[model samples]
Target: MLDESLLDDPEALARADRRELLRGAAEAGARVRTAVRHATEAGIAELKPDGRPRAVLIAGPGLAATGVAELLGTLAGASCPTTRLTPTGVAPASGALRWELPGWAGPVDLLLIATPDGSEPGLELLVEQAYRRGCSVVAVAPAGTPIVESVQGTHGLFVPMATAPYEPTEPLAASAPGVLWALLTPLLVLLDRTGLVSAPPEALEKVADRLDSVAERCGPAIAPYSNPAKTLAAELAEALPVIWTEGTSAGPAGRRFTAALAELAGRPALTAELPEALAAHSVLLAGALAAGADPDDFFRDRVEEAQALHARVVLLRDRPAGGLTAAPAARELALSHDTAISELEPEEGGELETLAELIAVTDFAAVYLALASRA
Candidate 1:
C-alpha cells in the first residue's frame, strides 16, 4: 500500500511542490487553448479566396496520409478540391483548377506538404515546385526548424512538427489523436464558417466546441489505461513483448486483458520496450490468444534467450476448444476458457464469481483501474 503520510504530509515543502506542479499544468493548458484560438482566427482570416485553387495534400506513407488527406478534404469543401499527392504521382483531379507538380502541366493553387523532420530532399523539391507554380505553400514538419520562420514571413504557413494537425508518431498515444484533432479541426471549421467556403461561424463553432468538450472529458479517462504510451511503459518494466494489431471490430478485448493484469498487479501498467530491471526475474509469457497474435515464436525464441529462465505459457483461445496443445521444448503450456472481455460484450452477470476466480488462480499484488473511451 502507498504510504498515506506521503500523500497527506504536513511538510510545508511537499505542499509547495504539489501546488507548483498542478498550477504549472493548468497554466500550460490555458496557454495552449489561447494559442490555438489565435491560430484558428488567423487561418480563417487568410482563407478568403478570390478564386478557388486546387488544394493538394502531399503526404508521406502510412496512416498520416489517410488521416490528413481526409481532414484537408473536409476543410476545403467545394471551394477547393483536395487531392493526395505522393512522390511519384501528380495530385488528384477534382475541380477546375489544376495543381501541377514539377513534371505535370497545369496551373496550381495551394499545396499542403506533410513530411517528417530531417526529410530534406523530398520536402525541398516539393516546395520548389509549388513556388515555381506560384501557389501558396503550407509545410507541416516536426518542431525545431529554422526554415519555419522563413515560411511564415513569406505568407506561407509552417505548422510545426509537434502541432502538425495530424497524428504522426508511432506507438500512437490514445490522447494524441484527439488532442491534434481538437486543435486542428476547429481551425478548419472556422475557415468554412467565415465564408471562405460555405458554412456559418455559428454552426461551425457548435461543432468545434462539441469536439473540444468531448476530448476534454474523455482524454483523461483513456490516458491511464487505453493509451499505448502507458501500456508500453508498464510492459517494459516486466520485460514483456508488446504487440500492436488492428481490431477487426469495435470491441476492445485485448485491452481488457491488459487492464485486468494491471488490476492484479496493483499499479499503473503499460506495454513498452523491455526494461533492464526485469533481468532478475524469470519472465513469463501470459496473454490471451484472442488478441490474434501467434505466441509460439514469441515464447520460444524471445523468452528462451535468457540463460537461466523458466516460463509458463498460457494461451486463452475461444471456447469449446479449451484444451492443451502440443508444447515446445522446455515450455509448460496450458489452455484456459475464453470470456469475452471487450467493453461491448454483454456482462456475464457473474462479476463476483469472475473476481473470485481470478483471485484464486493468480497471485494478487495490487490493482488499479484505468478507463479509456473514444471521442
Candidate 2:
C-alpha cells in the first residue's frame, strides 16, 4: 500500500529534498559562471563608459520590457533620464541607452534587451548592433534560454534577469512594478557592493536592508524538513515527462516553483517564468494522470486551472460533501475542459494536512537527486 503518512509532514520531506537540489543548482551556476568567464576573457572586453549616457528605454508592448525599464530607471538614481521609444519619433539625446531596439544615431553607452521569454528576433539584431557600435550589451532572457550561448557567440555580456515570485491578481503587467523593484533593488545593491556602480555607502545599505526584508516576507517558504522550494522542484522534475501536455500557466508555475525551490535550497534559481522550467514536468504529470495509475489523478489534472485562478485546490479523500475536493472526478473533468491550470493538491482535508499530504507522497529525495544530475 502507498504510505500515506509521508504526506503528513510535507515540510520535512521538502527540506530533505531541497538540500540536494540547492547543491545541484550551485554546481550548474558555477558551470555557467565558468562559461561566462571564458567568454568575457576571450570574446569581448568589458565596455568602460567614459560618462553615463542618457538612458532611453524602448517601450515594447511586452510587460517584462516595461518592468525592466522602470527598474533600471529607479536603480540608476535621479541623474539618469528615461524616454519612451516609439515608432513615430525619437527623443532628442546625444548619448542614450536604447532597450531592445537599436534605432538611434551616434554611440550608445549601454544597450539592454529585456524579454519575458528571450525568444525575440529583435533582441538578436540589437545585440549585433551593439557589437558593431562597441556598446555594452545586456540581454535579459528568461532563465535557461540559450542566452549564454547567444551572448557568448555575439561576444557580449549576458546578465541573467531576475524577478521575485508573487501571486498577483492579473498577469505580469499588474505586478511587474513590485517584482521588478524587488529584483533590481538586490541587483543594484550587489553591484554597488562590488563597486561596479558608484553609490553612497548609506544608500547601498538601505537597499540591502530593504532586500533582506523582502526576502524574509515574500521569499519562498523554507525549512529544514519541508522547504517549499525543494518540494516544488521535486514535483516539477517528476512531472517533467508530460509537462507540455499540461496548460501553459501550469507549466510556468511548475518551472517557477522549481526555480524558487532551487534558490531556497541555496542555489541560483533561473530568472525566468516558472512555467518554462516546468514545461516537461507538466507534460509528464498530465500523461501520468492520463495513464490512471495514481489515485490522485483526479485532482492532479486540475492543478493548472487552480494555479491560474490563484486558488489552491486540495483533493480530500474524506471530507464533507460539496467542498473543494469533494468531487475529484468532476474537478478533473472541468480542468481538462479548461485552457488554463492552477495549483492542484490531492489529499485529505485541512490546509496544513493538505500540504503535508502532498509533500509526503512526493519523492523529495529524487528531486534533490535531479538537481545533482545537472552538469
Candidate 3:
C-alpha cells in the first residue's frame, strides 16, 4: 500500500527516492535547454533542408522513445506519414530485439533514431540497413556508444543526448522521468528544420520555462493540498487510473502518463481519448472497479488481503471548455457510476509548451508514486 503520509513529509519522500526519480523530474526544464544546445552544436538548427522527407520513420526502445514517436507524429499531422518502427523479431544474437525497415522504405524516407542508451546492436544494424536503402538518417543518443559510431560512419547526422549534471556520476533509472525531454527536444528541433514541426528556438525556450513553472508548483516541498502532482498521486492510491485526454496533444500526454505510471511506479493504468474513453471503459465503471459498486469493499479485511482497486477518471485537457471537449459528459458518467474524477488543464501557452506542462506535472506525479510506494 502507498504511504499517504509520505506525500507530505519531504524528508521521508527524499529518503524513499533511492533512485533519484525526484531529481530526474526536477531537472526536466534544464534537460530541454541542454538538449537544444546539443541540437545546435550538432547543426540541426542550422540545417537548410532541401525539403521534407517523403515519410518519417522513428526507431527506438523504451517508453520515452514511444512517447517521442507518438508526440512527433501528432505534431507533424498530415504533413507526411510518420511511423514508429517496432521490433520485427529477435536478432541473430539470442533474445536481442531487432528492428527492420519496411519493404517500401527507400531513398526519400527519413529515419530518426532516439534512444537513452546507444549500445543496442540492433539499432546499429538498423542504421546500416537505412544506409543501404539510401534513406536519410538522423539520430540522438548518448555520446561514445556503438550507435553513435554507426550513425557517423553511415554519414548520418548525430546529436548527443542531453544529460543532467549528476547523470554522468550517478546511476539514474533507464526509465527516468527527465530522459523523455532530453531525447525529445533535439528531434523536435530537427523536425522544425525539416519544416515538419514548429518548434523554433524561442518556442523551445518557452517550453523549458513552462516545465520549470510546473516543477515549482509540483515539487515535493510543497504541501499535497496545493501540489497537483502529489494530490493526484494520493488520489490514485488503490485506484486504477482511466486517463481520458482531450485535444490533439493531450492524447500523447495521456498515454505517456500511463507509461510513466507503469514504468516508474509499477502501476497499471488505462488510457483513451475523451469521447472514446467514455465507451472504452464504460464496462469498468459499471463493473467491479466502480467506486461504489461493492458495498462490502469498505469492510473487507485490511490486515489479511490487498486493497480493492477502483476506477478514477483523470481528465487531461488543454483545449477550451466548449466544442473541443467531452469532459463534462465524461465527468457526469463517471460520477453517476460513483467514480471520482480529477481534471488538469495547462495554463495558456503554445501547443508544445502546454503539452510539456501536462507531461511534466504527470511525470512528477508518477515519480512521487514510485517514491512513496514500495513493494
Candidate 4:
C-alpha cells in the first residue's frame, strides 16, 4: 500500500528516496547540457561525415541501450535506417549473451553504442568486430571504463556518459532518470551533423528548458491536487496501467513509462499503440482487471489485505499522424468498460521538446511511486 500522505510531504519523500531517484529526475535538464558539452569536447559537433551511412547498427546490453536505439530509429525514419543488433551466439563466453554484426553490415554502415555500464566485455568485443568490418563507430559510456580503451583503439569516437554530482551506486538506479539524457544527447548532436535528425544545439537547449519547466511543476514540493506526477502515482498505486499512446512521439514515451515503472517503482505495466491497443487491451478492461468486475470488492476487509488491482487507461497524446487522432475512440472504449483514465497531453512544441515533456512528467511520477510506496 502507498502512503498517500507522503506524496505531499517533501521531506518525507526525500527521506524515502535513498537511491536519490528524485534528484536524478530533477537533474535531467542539467545532464542534457553536460552531455552537449561532452559532445563538443569529443569533437562530435565537428564531424564532417562524407555522407550518412548506408545503415546504422546499434548494440548495447540493457534497457537504456534499447531505448536509445528505438528513439533514434524513430527519429531517423526514412532518411537513414537504424537497426538494433540483438545478441546472438555460438562463440559464447561462459554461456553469456553475445552480439554479432549482420552479414550485410560493411564499411558503409555506422555502429552506435550507448550503455550506462562500460565494463561489458561483450560490448567491447562488438566494437572490435565493427572495426574489423570497417564500419564507422561512435559510443557514449562512463569515463575510464575498459570499453573506452577498446573504442579508442578501434578508431571509434568515444563520448563519456555524463554523470550527476551524486551518482547512485546501484546500476539500475543510475540508469533510471538523468543518465538517459547523458546517453542520448551526444548521439543526437552527432546525428544532427550527419543530417539524420534535426537536433541542433539551439533546439537541444529548448528541450533542456522544457525539461526544467516540467521538473518545477512535478517537483516534490508540489501537492498532489496540483501536481501531475504525484496525482499519477496515487492513481497507479493499485492499478495495472494499460498505457495507450496515440502519437508517434507518444509511443516511445509510453514504453519508457512502463520500463521506468518496473525499474524504479518495482511495478509492472502494459503498453500498446492506439488503435491496436484498443483491441489488444480490451480484454484487460473487460476482464477481472476492470473496475466493475467485483461489486463486493469495496466491502472486503481493508485491514485484511491490500486493495485489488484494476485496469487504468493512461492516454499519452502528442501530434497525430495525417492530422487524425484515435484518442476519442480510446476514451470511449475505456469508459464503456467502466475503467478510469489518466491522460497526459503535451503542450505545443517541437518534436524533441514535446518528447522531453512526456518523458519528464512520467519519469517524475515513477520516482514518486518509488519513494512513497510501502514495502
Query: 1 or 3, which is superior by TM-score?
Result: 3
Better of 2 and 4 by TM-score: 4
What would the TM-scores of all predictions be?
0.40, 0.35, 0.95, 0.96
- Locate the minimum summed-lDDT window of 10 residues in model 4: 88-97
Arranged by TM-score, best first: 4, 3, 1, 2
Model 2 segments beyond 4 Å from truth?
Answer: 1-48, 54-61, 75-78, 84-103, 162-208, 214-375
- Candidate 3 — which pairs collide? none
lDDT, residue 109, candidate 1 = 57
lDDT of 3 by residue, 273-346 (tens): 87888888899899999999989878999899787889999999977436567887998999999999999999
Error of 3 at 159 (Å): 0.4
The best candidate by TM-score is 4
Per-residue accuracy of model 4 over 1-375 as CA lDDT, tens digit each: 788999989999888887878888899999999999999999988889998899988887667877888889888889998999887665433136578899999999999988787887888888999999999999999999988999999899999998877656554553488878989999999999999999999999999999999999999999899999999999999899899998878999999999989888889999999889999988889999999899998799999877789999999999999999889999999999889999998999999999999999999998888788852
How many clashing pairs per prediction, in order?
A: 12, 40, 0, 0
Tally clashes: model 1: 12
User: By summed lDDT, which 10 consecutive residues of candidate 3 come out lowest?
Assistant: 88-97
For candidate 3, the per-residue lDDT at 283 reads 91
Report the candidate with higher TM-score, 3 versus 4. Answer: 4
